[model samples]
Target: MIIDVLKNIARFLILSLLQVLVISHVPLGSHFVLLPYVLFILMLPFETPKIIVLFASFVLGLTMDAFYDTGGMHAAACVLMGFSRTHILKLISPREGYDNVMKPTVQYMGKTWFSTYALILIFIHHFVFFYLEVFGFSEFFSTLLRALGSTLATFVFIYIVQFLFYRNDKISI
Candidate 1:
């Protein structure tokens, strides 16, 4: 139990730092934003309580907001992503349901399931984030396009990270 908590804490710090110091400055151009930080929320164990997830999500977003000076935009989007996580899990859950220890990772869930899962959550995160950043529907289609493009980029990066870090199979290298 304590080990899991420690691991999660490490994950949060590493991912958040990666977002602020690395990915944030990658210059993906105006349309595509990469937010691998969202994976921190997505990869939480299935049994985590909703409130904890929400709190963590808020803290993660606030950290990003602190760095980006985006006010509360990231916080709002992350909170919404945390809020919708369980529902999305349920929506994509197997007929037999999930194992208690199962995590939402490509290694455990397979590429297709993980891809589907990540895509939806990333889209939700990106859409809410970009829209809130813009704060209006003035350029509705452009906002949608930005959200979609960012979603795709974020999804790809998240999956690659998951596969590289969490995959059970040993690579020969």
Candidate 2:
């Protein structure tokens, strides 16, 4: 129990630093913002309480907002994503229904399932974030395009992080 908590804490710090110091500077054009920080929220344990998730997400977003000078946009989007996480999990739940898994990872859930789950949540996060940043409908098409592009870019980075940093520990006997 304590180990899991420590692991999550470490993950949060690592991802936060990566977002603020590294990914934020890797310019991918105007429309594509890389929010790999969302991966920290998405990779949280399945059994984590809803309130805890929201709090953690809010803190994470606020940290980003402090760095990016986006005011509360990241916080709002992250909170919404955290709020919607439970429903999304229920929506995409497998027949077995998460009885064995603690965390949702590509290794545990398989590529197809993890990809679908990550893509949907990331899209929600990016869509809300971009819309809030733009703050109006005058540039609706551009905002939508930016959200979609950022979602794709962020998804790619998250996937790479999962593959490279997180290893499959389950052994086949």
Candidate 3:
């Protein structure tokens, strides 16, 4: 139990640092990339409780907001993503079954499942975030264009990173 706690804490800190770095360094057009943070959320163990997940999401977003001076936009979008995570999991659940040991990854879930899952969550995060930041639909088309472009850029960046960095081991789902 203690080891698990320590590992999770370490994971949180590392992910937080990565998020900050990605947000500060990477540019998707006019906005800093936020998709790596979504990957952080997705990388959490399947058994993590919704409340804890939501809280972590909020903290992650708040941290980014602090860096960007965006008040609570990132926090709101992250909280929303956390709120919808369980539903998304249900939607993309494995065909055979899922063990408690399961982790979200392309190998564990398959590329199709992983891509679909990431795309949906990324779109949700970017749409809410960009829209809220702009605070208007008066420029509906432009806002959507920005949102879509950023989402694609973020998704591609994260996907390539994951592919290069992580190795997959087959486990029973």
Candidate 4:
């Protein structure tokens, strides 16, 4: 129990710092925003309580907001992602269902599943984020273009990071 807590804490700090300090600095043009910090929220254990997931996501987003001064844009998006996570998991759950200890990492679920999952969440997050940032639909196509651009970039970045960094969960079968 304690170990899991510590690991999550480490993940939060490391990812948050990397997001604020490093990833945020890598400008992918004006339209593309790299959002690798979200991987931390998306990779939480499948069995994690909903409240904890929502709370953690809020904290993570708020931390990024603190760095970027985007008010609660990230926090709102994080909470939206957290709210949608369980539904997405249910939609993609295996035929045998999930193990109590299962995590929604590419290392555990494979490329296709994780790709779909991540892309959907990223698109939703980016859509809300960009739209909310503008708070209007006057520049609909332009906002959408920016959101899509950032979504694709963030998704690719998260996918690569998962492959290179996250450990493959051992299957006991």
Question: 41-158 in candidate 4: lDDT tens per residue?
Answer: 8888888898999999899889988998999998999889888887898898899999976678777787899998999888888889888889899999999999999999999999
**Residue pairs in candidate 2 whose N, alpha carbon or C atoms collide under 3 angstroms:** none
What TM-score does candidate 1 get on C-alpha atoms? 0.94
Superpose all Cα atoms of candidate 1 onto the true structure and report the RMSD in Å to 1 decimal: 2.7
> Which TM-score value belongs to model 3?
0.87
Q: What is the C-alpha lDDT of each candidate?
A: 0.89, 0.89, 0.78, 0.87
Which of the two candidates, 3 or 4, achieves a greater TM-score against the reference? 4
lDDT of 3 by residue, 1-173 (tens): 56756766776677678777755566545743445667777776788888988998898889878877999999999999888887898887877656776667777777888888888888888899989988888878777877787788778877886777666556654
Q: What shift in Å separates residue 21 of candidate 4 from its native position after superposition?
A: 0.5
Instruction: Give one digit per residue, the lDDT tens place, for model 2 in 108-140.
Output: 787898999999999999999998998988899
Badly placed stretches (over 4 Å) of model 4 are 167-173
Candidates 3 and 4, the one with greater lDDT:
4
Ten-residue stretch with the least lDDT total in model 2? 164-173
What is candidate 2's TM-score against the reference?
A: 0.95
Each prediction's total of clashing residue pairs, residues at least 3 apart in sequence or on different chains, is 0, 0, 1, 0
Root-mean-square deviation of every model:
2.7, 1.3, 2.3, 1.5
Of the pair 1 and 2, which is ahead by TM-score?
Answer: 2
